[model samples]
Target: MTAVGAAAEIDTYMLAMPSPDSPVVLPQWISRGNTHPNSRYQDPIWSMAPLIDNPGTGLVKLHWKNCPGPLLDQVKLAAWTMINGQLRPTYLQTRGVQARSRSGGTDMLATCHEWMRLARWLHERQITSLAACAETEWRAYANERLSQVSRDTAAIICVRLANLWAFDQLSARPSGIARPPWEAEGVDDFLPAVGTAGGGENATEPLDPRVLGPLLIWAIRFIDDFADDILAAWAERRRMVAVAAAAKAAPAGWAALEEWLLPMARAGHPLPANSGKSEIQVATTYIAALTGSNRGQVSRFVKQYGLAEIAAERPGPCPLRVPVTGRINGEPWREHVDFNEAAELMKHLGTAATIILLYLTGMRPQEVQGLRSGCCPDPAPTADGTDGRRLIHSHHYKNVTDDDGNHISAGEVRQVPWVAITPVVHAIRVLERMVPEGELLLSTAHHEFHSRHGHAGALKKHTLTLRIESFVNWVNREAGVQGLSDQTIPEDPQGAIGLGRFRRSLAWHIARRPGGLIALAIQYGHMRTVLDARTSSSYGARGRGGIHAILDVETALAAADTAARLRDRVAAGENVSGPAARRALTAAAHTPRFEGRIVPRTFARKASTFLARDGIVLYDNPDAFLICAFKHDNALCEPEPGATAPRQYDCRPGCGNTVRTDTHAHQLRERADELDQFAAHAPGPVSKRLHANASRLRETADTHDATAHSAEALT
Candidate 1:
């Protein structure tokens, strides 16, 4: 046979392997023989062919694996080519080479896998080339794929196929080959609906404060009062185990001088045949059953065994406890944690620290997990001489991408102001002590059994997720036992609290709460600024951006709430103060009521557009109403936007933006009464000034009363 014919035959062969001297080399992470057991890529057929790239010529090749005979022949005949002194397929050059060279092997491999699925589908239908495929055929293929997999997976397949067909039209067709029937249509037209190919809305709801608050209090108490004892006990247990092991392997006379220590060898002796087990053995068995560990193992050990004994002998009262009436298999049980169980305790502490950092600082979960031993540094004094709050220096990994859309290994370091709360700071200190310096704070040390990749010292996202759920359950149980049912963390019927929700929750609370709660006020300003800057930059102004998206949603809810309240007052003939208040009331009359907490999408869009006019934002203050026409330069509250939201706490009575509701009128009347009392007892000059202030307050109150009376008469 001729050389060209032989080469053509070799390319068409389904099982033909690449030559040993081929330029392409599979990526380091890709498995060679059968795929690695832990690999996410589980497709046995796809796993056979590794992703191969040649750096020398900037080319990558993906050989089909376990491909049917007809599919292999069609791909070889249709789009295979040699480019840049390397043999590759045209599709690979169009998609795989760029992905491999500029991004990473995973991306390139993913594209290759998609192409393989498309090829297999076409071959199954007995189609030879792209020219035979059309919209109807594409839809049929998509439906078949969807039946076997998820909508997302089917969408991906359709997208990849569409891209390949487009590439075939542009680059693969030879002299006699006809163009594909759908060549004129863009790839998107033949693809699934845009959002159908992605995961559903992420659970971004934050942990309920009722749940978070008690957990934080318990965690702080654990760190400050009990953590050291737990650590020391675990260490002592380790030392005892080491000593016992050494005594077993002693050089003959190691324990000769210590007669008391020698009896420990007999401690493991089985209970006598007719004798009932001791109270300690029964307790050990009960704890084993509760914790789901081994009963024999728990009873045989000494230093780490007899959890009840450890609890009884501990220096202070044990922080962990079971109910006095707790029962296991109808036997009375008391809660006691063994020294060896300190590992699980430490895990809980780690989770607490993670929660404190994530929730308090409004840091992303990734940012909290990325924290190393030295992440939280002592607060430096500000220019005015007061010591500032602590600052957390950690890496922000999300949304960091290189020019080619590849994730940069070490993300940008962001310094966030730590919440001034003592619990938050104490939690950071405790986490630092848990692991050695330079290691991640939320390491996998506590729950090593759950980790599969020997990431015992590196926390995983799923691990944190599970820990948070467990922490909530534990906190709730403890609260119930202590008769603090009100403190129990409320269960979210929607879903468990997730890592991403912390920052968004912070933003939502800051934006929606009336005058903002004090606990939030102390930290919200700095958090909102950082989040707004990050999210606004990442996702443009109009898009539902990250944390900013939550803020926007909350803002809409707040506005709708404000409108509803104003409408209720207007309907009941209550007065509203200021010209803007009147205008807002008029607007509210026409606006529809929000049925639930969630503002409808159409209403939200309209509200956003409406609220944007005149930089208007409503602030629900207790003493006075505020409709901030936020003109930064003209603001009377402050020279510039500062940490505290100006409209909420710094509203100036004389500012053009200030407004008042009936609640404000009540506050004014109370102030007037106090001033009148002071004026009656003061000397002449003081009394005159006090009287003038009192008069003004009364006049404002009367004005509100008269407005309400007029509205009532009109109604």
Candidate 2:
């Protein structure tokens, strides 16, 4: 049925859409039990408590606030036409277009907005509908649709509807609805952009200063109704997919311009003979502009981010014919790291987004090279019983208003929820304050991303090799050479941690929680079934491996047991391992007495499939995993007296096999990273000490290696 056909579902959302201008009276208690369908939303202190025990009807205060502008209003209206009015119609049109255009039945019809994002978009426009046809569902808008005026017409309808809605919300225009009785007296022209996409109803698009402004915003609001996601994904994984990331994403600037020019040369691309006047020489500059920033911002970001001049200019490491430098743990290996090489360890943090992605998600270098400004939300969605806008929605990945302010881009944007420890919330808030509306939310652009989808560009296309092996070597080079061999720079475990691990690992963590990924992962996947339908790929051939790696089940089990003994010892008034004097034992070596306990990566995958930037799954060597103690897994890494020391339990000695030292400590010298994922939630001081110890442990290991080197030289 057409969306117009499913009128009832539309009212399921819109009866509460609040055209109410003044206070409307209602009974003290709601008539029907109200179960807000969105599990993502948490009840705020000031908000109505959703009576979920029984679903029902209840009237909510309808004070409107934070409305959009005239043009924005028009755009909102247009958006409504397409999203609500033409929901089924557009799907039919788009479906026919897809079928007729190519027999291939391409996957391009998928919405750029994920389930929750689309839901949020709909809710904000006051077009809240529970109808399947009204959902931000798939409609193929290909080149065929692009050629058709209806496609643009649909987009135009979307923007107009959204603009008007935002304006009404801001009180710039009159609200079409009535107000509720319970609202306080001072609330006039009440407009709230609550639960809006981009976390607000402002609807500002990031555009380079060199370009036109307001009209551009209009173009964005009008044209970008739902096409950005499709376009961005197409750009990222398009004809470009076959190309390796190293080539597409290389930091190539001037030095390798000669070779990079070959692609254009092959196509006889345009370039002025004079590099200065020529766009080719300034391709990076253009990339910044087209991507909604000034040339300077893009140039500075690319340079500071240490991008290669061209793919070929990217640095490469010379693999050893032999272990020229030394060995780690008596194995044939590379250079040694000095752990006590320093006293009190200090770590300088980068921009919070970078640091968080580095510290929390464990994303890698090139993968993060092109963080499209603010694609990662400032405050992730929080579950502390508040409106869910604080949650980080994932649509930022597909399109973020490119240079012309009329284009799109794609990739996996962060979908992190805000049910985190306080510091993470603060860090998120800090980011919100710092970001400019049209600017990239990231500290610096790692490379020039001219496409609609920013980072989806392969690194190798710009010129270096793109394999994970190459990525490993590049990071290893810094650790092994400039930093390791010279000893000037201390070892950073985060260096070895790359993009491949985060989604799977996070999935594993989520899987172990009570309600499984649903309860643990927080926020949502639009609806229940969307998350549950992953068996095809998740446990399927290409996907199961990722679930295996997400959690180190072996580690968790071992860790759990260690905690129990420690607990029993405390209860019995006995010291663990016959503790005599002071403090409880460190839990770094908690051993789960039960063999069956495991971290639930499979369930995590089922829950967090939306998070995987690419469908590709990550796998870990089965031998590499072990059970974990909750505290030890989260942090509080130390040895339990009755349990084996983390060091003692190693493949040999001093190991947890994490990229960290304790995680990194026993394996301080290894390149695999074990950066702090738990620090965000830790009691501040203890977390600091733990990070310090990890850094220091690496330094000490470095020192010990240095001494051994000196001894060998004396011999």
Candidate 3:
């Protein structure tokens, strides 16, 4: 056919094409219809094409046709053939044939790009089709790929090429073409083993307690004491707006009277338009002066009639000018409200509340962000029936997937226990007031720059991330100005704090805080209880999914760190405390010094299998005031079935499982001194009791001291 005739024919074929939303079979490629008949078929992975500069024009353009034209056309044809089940029986039986189910345009695009790269490599070696490439060429390509990108990336590239080669071989055999030598070869042989990418796991460090401490303390004070100021300010602004609207809608000459009277009202000047001198009295005097009316008439107009008009014409809600004054990181600071500041304060309040809930409840970031109005409407008594401990009902969205691997819209609501912290509950109530009725607590309003775009409902992960970063920056800046550098959350060396790190950090702190020294110093006694409950019971219940996985990893790391510390102490000849001191010392002696191996260190730290063979495992229990050298059923610390660790809160003082460090010995000394001081000041029975407690503390301290001296002498 002539060129013009072929062009006309192609145009007619395009015009006769099915709708993009409809599935239709392409001629010469497939006989069957699309697998996903209800959904539109797309050539996946095409959008990832890189833009390249046109060497002739120096202009950048998307290199859509960069792949070999004939090969590209053949791939497109193969895609249709695979989708419609027109492939050979051999191809149909292959495990990789399932790639056909990934019919999206992006998926096809990625496959096409990989095929194009292989085709280019073959062409460079003077080979034509994939069937012409030998094992040597494939090896060369694999080597080139490994040198260019990550092992995972190279593996993906090889896998895609292998799939395409398999398809090409299946197609060629039917057409009487010879198979390529590389066709039967496995890409797996050339590719490195790939595991799940860590992706910021190492980089996501927790917020420092030094910073979080003051930040939360300020947040509590802000929510408890200063949050009401926002409401009052809002009401005042609304009232002013209502008065202004009423004045505008007043009688024909009232606008002129208002214009004349407002200046005098603001200036505290006695209006010549009215009679009285005082500000309140001058308002009636101002009306009389302006309208040429008597004082009695003006008084009645101001009180009974005009005042009712202003009250009736109430305006819609207006932005509030909240008064903010606080000492961030121990430095006093003050801020006046304007439009931006008011919006910012509102956002800060929301973020503060979010931080408190996440930090205190140990809830995942998504779980906290997913919190809607009336989530925790009523706080009930905790499982233990503790007076101050309460349980909050909230939803968790992670792992809420349907049978088809799609996430359900609404999350599963679970009752979180021991949330009886008053400040946290108070923060929740404050958040309730900040948002409109039935709206999300951490809504788009918390995004100050984006609030004007209307209520976007629940906070997105990225939005919360940005807000947290901004919140941290604001706290740091405010604290810096107040010379409270010590109180400021320091910039992490790994990276800024992210939402995922909170739960892990809490677990780490609980498992590793030495003798509850830092925990007690930080005033997190209640938190220690919560952490213990979560680590012991909740960890196993959740089955190592989502946040539970992070907690498990951190817990293992904490255990390893504790073991390492114990080893160092033993090496330094420092005496071990507790009933299991001898066993703990033996285990410490066996712990191999970790040089530069992370995987082995992680294994040694987390897994008790090796330690179990020797009848010992170092268990961290900071709240128990000593580490536990647990020996399964023989543990002096009662071991709960199906629980990997002992309950620190239920720790027996003389339990053979316990192993105290030097810090514990120091604490005993301090306690002895404290008791002695109390006994000296007490009278009669109290004095006798105090003296007895002091003597016990002194004896324990002396025992630890003597052990330490003996170990030193032996060394």
lDDT of each: 0.50, 0.28, 0.52
Leading candidate by TM-score:
1
Return the lDDT, model 3, position 283: 38
lDDT score, candidate 2? 0.28
| Tens digits of per-residue lDDT for model 1, 1-715 | 7554555466542212233232233233233441322212212222212332111111123455645565554443222221101223443455432332122333345545665676677777787665566667766765565566544565455544544543333322222233333334533454445444243222245456555556556665566665665555555544444444333323233233123222432354232111124432233332332333343444444344343343333322222332233232354322454533555666676777777676666566666766678876887789999986565666665445455444333455653333335566788788777777887776665335323454323466676789888877877776677666766777664567777767656655666543444244534544445443433222112243334445555665666576677667766666666645644555556545666343333443464464454434454555343454344455575532322234344556666555566766877878878888998999999999998987888787777666543333333
Q: What is the lDDT of residue 324 in candidate 2?
A: 24
Clashing pairs in 1: 211-489
True lDDT of residue 73, candidate 2: 34
How would you encode candidate 3's per-residue C-alpha lDDT over 111-210 as one tens digit per residue?
6667667767666766655545566666677777656664556656665666565444333122112332344665455655554232333224666665
Candidate RMSDs in order: 10.7, 24.7, 12.1
Ranking, TM-score, top scorer first: 1, 3, 2
Q: Which residue runs does candidate 1 get wrong by more than 4 Å?
A: 1-136, 143-233, 249-337, 409-424, 445-453, 514-521, 525-553, 568-574, 578-580, 586-615, 622-639, 642-715
Q: Of the candidates numbered 2 and 3, which has the greater TM-score value?
A: 3
User: Of the candidates shown, which would achieve the greatest lDDT relative to the real structure?
Assistant: 3
Which consecutive 10 residues in model 3 have the weakest lDDT in total? 49-58
TM-score (C-alpha) between model 2 and the true structure: 0.23
